[model samples]
Target: MNISYKWLKEYVDFELSPQEVCEALTSEGLEVGSLEEHQAIKGGLRGLVIGKVETCEAHPNSDHLHVCTVDLGQGELQQIVCGAPNVAAGQKVVVATVGCKLYDGDKEFVIKKSKLRGVESNGMICAEDEIGVGTDHSGIIVLPESAKVGMPAAEYYHVESDYLIEVDITPNRSDACSHYGVARDLYAWLVRHGMKTSLHRPGCEAFKVDNHDLDIAVEVEDNKKCPRYCAVTLKGCEVKESPAWLQERLQIIGLRPINNIVDITNYIMFAYGQPLHCFDADMIKGNKVIVKSLPDGTPFVTLDGVEHKLSHEDIVICNEEEPMCIAGVFGGKGSGTYENTTNVLFESAYFNPTSIRKSARRHGLNTDASFRFERGIDPNGQIYALKQAAILARELAGGTVSMEIK
Candidate 1:
């Protein structure tokens, strides 16, 4: 279990540095594996700014190069030859001046005052990956149009000091797999050390099933195989990119942010110790959902674009039309939520561990949801978890309360 220091701070207020927190957690029986600091390339790349693009004439000697006079905000213009097609006047960009060391890939390059096409060039502009935010480097980063001429880009970008701490949690400590659980442990540590602990529960209440529009009808075809099941339906949702705070929270935990709808489900699962799934209500072929054993040789495609064959013993989720998702394992491609989806049907149910494990092993699809269901989570928290997802969805995605099943 990887616990990001940034995410861990939300649950508890501790004065300890990230390294100190890791050491403290490790001393209290939780194994802190390693801490990784993601830093940007280019030393002395601190305060340079894109003052102005004085001249952007095509390089006389090179076809793809543009020689421009860039204002470094220190009252003097610097000449640099840039290859990016988007370089323009008044665009704020990073300037790695001469004598600066930069990390490209596995090696480092020292920037030196050089001549390009007979023009004395001083520095180079940077991309996202070149500055270590992400792997995207298709184009030069255009600073926010409002960025001041001489302001430090690092301060504006907040890339100064962030670290990721890897946590090794034992099987019995499944609760620690979540941010709340880790915070619980940290709270205990704070109390033990006579320090202040201020962890509070979310103000939003658990979702109630009786107050929605659409009714959720769940047919547990084999109760012996799937011991418990719960579902909720939400209407009028807007599926879009998650808020920066939510995306950063997930990114800190090593999860790539998909969208607000999906991020809410994942956030609820990590926060309340229950796994939840959200289906685009309109994408479901039928109004009803059936959870049952798969028939012999039923074929399905999961969300990851992988095809899987199901046997009789495997459990799956189906509508009147076809098997839409492999229950407790993975969602099928045909019935997934997309950018235009509005209504959503969220699922938070308990399955027999053996049943899920068998189906996962058969399909060779072991995922976070499967791993949690296989090891067993708090079954009674099904409805509670579902409600949490609904609240987040409604809050983040602008959805209406529709229906729920307790």
Candidate 2:
């Protein structure tokens, strides 16, 4: 599990540095396997900053290239050559000047003064995928106008200098799979050891349900396999990119932020140690969910577009007509929330760890949700986790909340 140093601060305001925190975590039995600093990778990323395009004109020598003057707030404008189609004047973009080290996903290189197509190129422009911050390479990264010029891109984005701490969780210690769980342990250790620290301790957070007059229908055919199942109905939910804070939190922890609806479920999983799944309300047949074991040779496709055949030993989350989820494993492809998703059925459940482990290996699907389910989770926390995810869904995606599980 990779835990972000900055993210742990949200739960406990620890005054220790990131390295110190890693040491403290080890003492708490959350043994750290390896600690990596983002900026410390391959020396560092210096001279990377938010720059405003001052002027841009088509290159007389190259059709695809443009010459521009960028204002990096260094008291003088710098000349640069860019080939991104979306590069334009008055836009704030990422600038990697001479002496800066950059990674292009395939190789690491140093930015130096160079000439391209007869133009004196002093630096290089950046795209999201170019530096591996995201998968979008449609054009150069355009920062918001509120982005301050001359600010280091690392400081501006709050990443590029973060730390990634890798830890090993024993099968018996499934609770430490989440950052919150690890921090919770650390806090307890500090208190038991009588260590004094300036960090503000964030106690347990309560989930409140406002709208309760909802009609959500679900049935569990095999209670022995699935211990607890909880869900919340979100009406009129809009799917869109998550807010900057949410996206940054996920990205820093090596998770690709999808849409707001899906990100909320992922956030809850990492924060509360419960894996939640989001199903498009319309895709669920009869607006009902059923948890059961299927017969042998039952075919299904996962959200990642992979097909699998299930046996009687496998548990599934199905609607009245078809499988909506593979129980605690991967979810069905068609039932996932997407850009067109309006109504969402958010689900959080605890399954028999042994059953989930067996099914996961048989189906050859190893996912984050499955990893947690196979190790066990706090079944009693299902309702709290579901309602918390719903609140975030309503706030981030503009939805109406309705508690679905009793």
Candidate 3:
């Protein structure tokens, strides 16, 4: 498990350095294996700024390259030769100025004055991948007109850094799997050692139900296997990219950011140690969810596009028509949220650890959610995490929260 040193401080107010934090956690049984500082964007996007392309003309010597004059808000126009097929004038974009450093994984390269195809180039127009934010090399990232020219790209994008502490967790210590969980232990230790620190958490008092516009009924076939289940429906949500802060939080902990709907679920899971799933409500045939086991040799496709045969004891989460997820383990391919997904059915459930472990091993699969579920997470936190996710979805995805928690 990876814990962010800065994120951990958000909960426990300790005056410990990074090395001291590892020592403290090691003494508390959450042995820190390694500590490394992580930058959300390599080099923190220093020396990069927003620039407006003033003029774009084809390079005289190159067929594909274009020579452009860009306004960096520095009073003078910079002449740059860009190779992107989509480069055009009058567009606001990211500019890596001369002497700026960019990264391709661990490798680093510096931007300097150079000649490309006999045209003098001063800087570079950046693609999403070039800035370490995303993977889109087809074209440069275009900014909205509201973006301020000459603004530092780091400030514009709110780039930040944090320390990642990789901890080795034992199967019995399931409670320490999340950031809050680890903070709780640290808080207790601090109190015991006469430190005047307190534990703080992100408040969920803001969670409100706007209207019962959508309803999803849930039925559990076996209560013993699933002791608790909580769900909420969100309507009119725009599934798009998550905010920069959210993406940074997940990235520091080594999780790739998906869309907003899926990212919020992942954020909540790591924050609270509760695994949540989101399904495209439009794809659900009956607006109902049923938790039950399918027959032996039942074939199901997961999000990874792999088909797995199921045993009779495997618990499945199904809509009125068919199984949508391999309950607590992995989600189905078509039933999950997509780019056009507007309505979502978010679920939080507590499954039997032994059952989840058996099913996960049977299919030769181990997911983040299943890792937590198989080790026995807090059953009581399901509704709390569900409410937190709903609150985030409504705020970040522009959705209306459902009144009923099925």
Candidate 4:
């Protein structure tokens, strides 16, 4: 399990350095494998600044390239040859001035005067991936109009450095599966050692259902397999990119941020150690979710686009007529959150560890949700986690919650 030092500090107050925290965790029976420094942007985006495109014209020798003059807040304009089709005049962007270093994996290269298609370029426009902040290579990053020209990109983007602590969790230590759980254990140790510190959890007190606008019903067929299942519906969500703060938190712990709806679920899962799933409410036929087993030989495709035949004992989440998810294991291909998912059905449940383990192994799938479910997560926290996810979805994705949490 990877834990971010900065993220952990939010859950528990501690004055220890990253190394000290690792040592304390190790002393408390959670073996730390490694502790490494992590930068939000590789090199902290040093020598990069915000620039505005002053003039952009098609390259004389290339069909897709554009030669552009950019204002770097300096007296002189710098000419750059950009290959991105979206390069345009009067747009703010990130610029790697000459002498700036960019990294591709571990290899680093310096930006300098160069020619592209016979056009002399003095600097380079940066894409998110080129600077190690994201994995987008589609086009040069376009900054907001409010971004000041010539401001340091790192400062403008609030680039941060953190420490990643990798802990080797034992089979019996399932409670230590999340950031909050890890902090709880650390707090226990602090208390044992006579330290005055308190473990804090993200408040769910503000999680009041706004209305019954999108009430999705849930039914659990086998109590033995699933003891508790909590679900809430959210509507009017704008499924765009997550806020920068949430993205940073996920990225700091090595998780790729999807959209707001999906990222919020992932954030709550890692935060509370409860695996949560969100379904596009429009796709839930009959507005119903039934947790039960499908017959043997039933073929279903997971989100990864792989087809699997259902076993008799494999638990599935169905929406009136079709299986929408392999319960606590993986999501179905067409039922999960998408770019147009305006209404969401959030799920937080506790499944029998043995049932989840068998299903995961039978399907040859080892997902984050399955890992925690098969290890037995806190059953009682399902409602709290569900509420927290609903609160976040409404906050980050602009949604209204249903009055009933089924």
Position 41, candidate 2: lDDT: 30
What are the TM-scores, per candidate, against the unseen true structure?
0.75, 0.74, 0.76, 0.77
Better of 1 and 3 by TM-score: 3
lDDT of 1 by residue, 326-402 (tens): 88889999676789888889888888888888888988988888888877777687866777787777778877777
Give a tens-digit lDDT track for model 3, residues 85-124.
9989999999999999999888999999999988899999
RMSD of each: 5.1, 5.6, 6.1, 6.2
Candidate models: Cα lDDT each: 0.77, 0.82, 0.91, 0.91
Error of 2 at 184 (Å): 1.5
Give the least accurate 10-residue stretch of model 2, judged by summed lDDT.
197-206
The residue-by-residue lDDT of candidate 4 on 229-306, one tens digit each, is 888888898999998899988988889999998898889888889999999999999988899998899999999999
Q: Is candidate 1 or candidate 4 better by TM-score?
A: 4
The list of candidate 2 runs beyond 4 A from truth reads: 39-45, 48-160, 197-214
Clashes of 4: 1
Clashes of 1: 2
By the lDDT metric, which is better: model 1 or model 4?
A: 4
Pairs that collide in candidate 3 are none
lDDT of 2 at 222: 92
By descending TM-score, how would the candidates be arranged?
4, 3, 1, 2
